[model samples]
Target: MLLAVGLAVGLALLLWARRRCPRGAGSWGLVLRHWLARRWLARAAGWQRRRLEQACKDGPRSQELLLLEGAGTPAPDAATFRERHPLTRHSADGTEPPPSPRPPLGLWALLRSCCAASSPLQGSVLYLDVLARAYPEALSPRGTARFSWARGCSLPAAAWPLPSLYCAPEAVGAAPSRAAALYVQLLLALQERALRVLEAGLLSELYDALATLRASWEGLAQDLASGGLSPHLELPQGLRHQLEGLLAPDAARAAELRAECARGWDVIARRLWPRLQVVVVAEPGSEQLYWEALQESACQGLPLYSPFYSAAGVLLGLNLWPEQPEPHYLLCPGWAFCEFLPVEPPGAEGPPDTVPLADVREGQEYELVLTAQAGLSRCRVGEVLTVAGFHYRCPLVGPVRRLSQTLSVRGEGVPEDRFYRSLRRAVAMWPGARLVDYVCAESSLMGASSGACAPHYQVFVELQGVRDLSEAQRYKLDQCLQEDFPVYKSFRLKGSIGPLRLHLVAAGAFRELRDAVGTRGPMARVLRDHRPLHFIQSRVLS
Candidate 1:
């Protein structure tokens, strides 16, 4: 009896040791950590696979993703992305569904229907959708009871919405595999790095990896949410809270993480922010107060960061404004002109003859000059004699009228001389007609007779006494346009320019200009360029 009991005790001890040590048990903590790490890796892999499959099935146009994959390249750049996926060419009306929704469908059906869908890229979209769907527990809204449950599990109550996910051809073009192979590889690399950090028990590295993955996954979730690509998935609150907790112990680290996250969010926001029709600015010397007021007023409750001065610098660059100080020229960084304008001392002003910059106008010549200084500063101002007084307070700023640059169409930058010459020629072609106001736009008139799917430049002319011109005369005017601008002629052949449509406005059109403000005052007079053409004015030709 004593021998049997001793044998039983020995077996129990052996079992306990095996369970604790496993195959590679350097320590108790290492054993537990390894187990948990393995579990997480398996979970991540499963999640990734499911998401990828779903994205392929439900995305706008499967062909885009397929074509990208077939090209076996990295994702294209933004410009190239737009070139390959011309949203304008695809109908937004959604009047019809693709012929073959499935992959194995007939070639003609795929070409005619699938190719007609909204976006071509499918893998990223599918991945996001699947992530959202599979992780509902992580993404659900919280009630008081639910919040308690989440807290018990260390989950967050709120989840950030999915970001806008756009896959550019260039991004894919650079990849070894045209599809999301690189993305998957990146994910694997990140996971491997995270595992290494976990194995070494490097808390800082682990936290950093976790934060990065969290940001990436969150971005993917946001993209899916905004794209409306997948109905099953939502932002994962539980995961977000877990990520938040990872940085809770270190305040400084948390702040840095937050800043990085904010930047990522901004990238998503810039892509998804509802475009504003008008951007206004406050007048010179008042920008600081205006921006402060703006922050205090409408944006106080939001999670937005204070506008930085660098943001202002970028905007100034965009407007072709000089960065250096000049007499009479106020360095105003209003909310309209920049996302953030840091407070700085106004440098010595420009030349004594330097004029207070006048507001922008249509048909006026403007120069974007670079300053001769240690810093290459550029400013966008009206040409020497093209002074037009301020019209109205800018929508972005309360009372600033900054100059606006029209959008560029084609690789050929908008040459001021060529644009003005085109206008002059058009006016000269008409014996008695005087040009009153004009706005030119670079857009794709897709679905038009021209099968070309690229951007085209179109000029909107508001001429005096154009109401009497017959349809035949309108045709003649279009012909004259072809003769006047060689670019226009080339654009016509490329199917970039459409028939020169004339809109004769009531005399009040110019008088009503006072209602519009800022850089927009100039932009309103002339339609800024865009990829898909948007309507500029409500006034229609008779």
Candidate 2:
């Protein structure tokens, strides 16, 4: 009798809770899974913090003492570890580290945090769909989510209703068009409530998506009103079927988009996804140019959020407060033993001294170093980061650039940031022009075909709102470069360097090049050796 009564009461409570829950919000099992995942993450983070503290405490001891004396193992410390293990750059160190054992919870936490927003429940279009399954409320009809890459993602059945598109790796080329179609389809199906654009390619890809939307809005509006997929979008059969189902005849929404489309490209994102709250991007780095372009164009009025920073199988840091404008990452305490080597002058010899994370000062730039258990010794990731400020005890780092990608034609050795600034200034001088994508190559790579007698820089740019450039307009970039570097100016004046060559390509040239090259990473803005034939052949403006 007692058992029967308990079962009856539990069943009644469960049914009542189900009735009260929002439609598609998920069952009690999902709530339990979310709770477990969150708990595991907290524990993993706590373990790492404790390990870091212990390493510091035991760091002063001799290596001999640490190895021989079981009772006196030295505490892990960055400075002492640096003294023993020399720094290794990834390019120079070609061998992989032996698999190092990881605490189960720590490994799980690292995997869970990949492309995850600092707060998953509320971040639309920036949150990963796999995690969204653990909390169905994140996939509720009120909002949507986006992935940085769907290549490795295994989207469970639960994410289907989230109103976001996940293209299989095979369909990467058609993604922009498919994404545009899905955006319009959702806009029609959900009406005004479909005001979220979920995407995760950082700002550059987002800019491309907006451009595609502008090009296809009229055709998409027609498709939505007719309850069918746009013929131009080459999508998988299954995905096409799923998308077609949402294309119910929504004439009113179609008309709404058509009217908004007339307002211009600058107003497209805002007019379409007016309720979009936050923009999530990939690991923050030298993306300020892309961010500014986005701000001036489609992503106007949207708050930006960068949740956590990780790369090449390492969990680097987390942004505890993404509400702030400038993206800052708080270094993970337990992931790896951390150190920062101060950035030296261009010709500085040997490795400079390294400082522990605690010693990093505000505004100082440093290259990150890590000593971890994986047969990995002290490895310099070659990524330079600036200490932006701090969140409590941890340093808040903003990425500057990769050490290897700097341009060095005529030994000017201009860093990525400087070149980006010069290009940005040149773009600003041109009226009605917006930069889409650009790549720089030394004239030596292209030889005489570059149209320069001496060594120079061959720049290819894709621009919007500009067709042909007068010689004077193209010369502005050379002038800006000289202002940034006296060395380049001297070489040009001495006839040792040829005039900078600029080529304008068709709008989608770089996008096609990216697909052709394979998306292991974004096309290098500066190419050191070979120039892709796709880029050379696609030049439209003489």
Candidate 3:
């Protein structure tokens, strides 16, 4: 049959391709697939850029054509399109409102197309040896061909396809004991696999995962010796049996791991997996506090790498990590049209001064503006970035902070950088303390919960050591704040602003609070409202 002939030809071609690769080079199929994917991605990126540019040019005319191409009436031209649909804010409406203008391209459609162009080769190429060991069959031509059609799930573009244990935050929050049991299972499996690198959505998740391991190791060892999951875990029947298999009664190994854990979790990764190379996280510059905590907590001399930079569902830049002390995002070509707006003063408002991506200069800070086919003419994502240098024509940028993260009380307007610097200095002064995570809120929203009469700043911090601070330790933060900002100091002197109240929460309390509110994604450092602050108020250390 024709099908049989086709299969034979394909097999012959694959074998010939394998022979072409150098001797002892495992398999040529992976290389072929990778190179093909790379080519496909390049083509897709070019097409997407062209489509986005055409959509921007056509403007409202594009939408009219899409909706009424076969209708008798002709679509509006570019001039008519601009005259009829002037650029306006979402809130711009009269008593008798006109229909809101819709983007020529659908946001979700554009996002899907953008995601299609995402190449995972960068993140996975470094782990090819590990992957080959983990999945030899997948490296073969036949297996690769079969897997292309096998459907069940899809991975994020940057994620490596490897054995992973997934735990939903909601599930963990709902059943802590069950989650601990699952973590024990994961650890045992990881011990068998010798997992050397860990990757997660954010650095905080990585820290939380290890913290769970630290808390559950004793129970994990006991379960391993007994060759059973804990009875108290109350896991589902199918999962319980599966987990029991991982606990294969390795008493000596269990004891060794338990002993290593008992020594301390400071170098746990090194002790457990001596080859631990790096911990990779996705969010880089925005989550510096979590990054610091993760570094201290990981403690295996593990370097962290963030492979890509994304904002508001758009991929903007890719990191050239390890080359710089702090990773700078090199703007991704053909992904989206990027612009930078000079960051205006907090209250100063009018049309922003925006510079095209090509004109950006080094060491200057600007608010990032992106134009994509993402259901808007243009979107200023509130991300502030400083251009580090250039990679040819593309500017390398690092995140400063978000414009929305700026905090103001009585028009004092404290910028995020100043607050971060003050907090860093203050934390250094606190004896035996290191900041795990922190959030800030203006006292105006807190009402009596702030325990202050005048407007002030409320800083809630979770610390690794030092359960409670002395009066002097608590005052250090306020002192740092005043030293950093003269306007805040003036307000404090005039009694217009009260002292900054520092609240300490238990180590994992903030994670719990965020999960409880179903905010598993990145949350703003400065909360606009009091609800989340009030939610965590009960858990604050007295």
- For each candidate, what TM-score against the reference? 0.25, 0.73, 0.69
lDDT tens string, model 3, 1-542?
99999999888867766775432222576445443443344454456445434543543343344323322222353234334433432211111121122222222333334334332332233223323334332232211100000011122323223212121111222233423433643444333423444555555555556666677788767776777777767656765665555345667768887888878877776677554555556655547776666556555476666657766555566665443458787665445555578766556878675676667889888887655444433456767899998765667888887666778887787877678888989999987888777888888778776673888888888887788998888999999989988888999999999888888987777867654553334555787755677876777885
Per-residue lDDT of 37 in model 2: 48
In candidate 2 the C-alpha lDDT for residue 387 amounts to 94
Ranking by TM-score: 2, 3, 1
Residue-by-residue lDDT tens digits, candidate 1, 260-378: 44554333211221221111121122123222332333223222111111111122211111221211121121111111111122253542211112223333323322121112222
Give candidate 1 regions above 4 Å deviation: 1-409, 414-417, 445-455, 475-481, 494-496, 517-526, 529-536
- Highest TM-score scorer: 2
How does residue 47 of candidate 2 score in lDDT? 49
Better of 2 and 3 by TM-score: 2
In model 3, which regions exceed 4 Å deviation? 1-157, 160-185, 223-231, 234-252, 344-351, 464-467
Q: Candidate 2 regions off by >4 Å?
A: 1-84, 92-142, 147-197, 226-228, 238-252, 346-350, 372-376, 518-520, 529-533
Better of 1 and 3 by lDDT: 3
Selected candidate, larger lDDT, 1 vs 2: 2
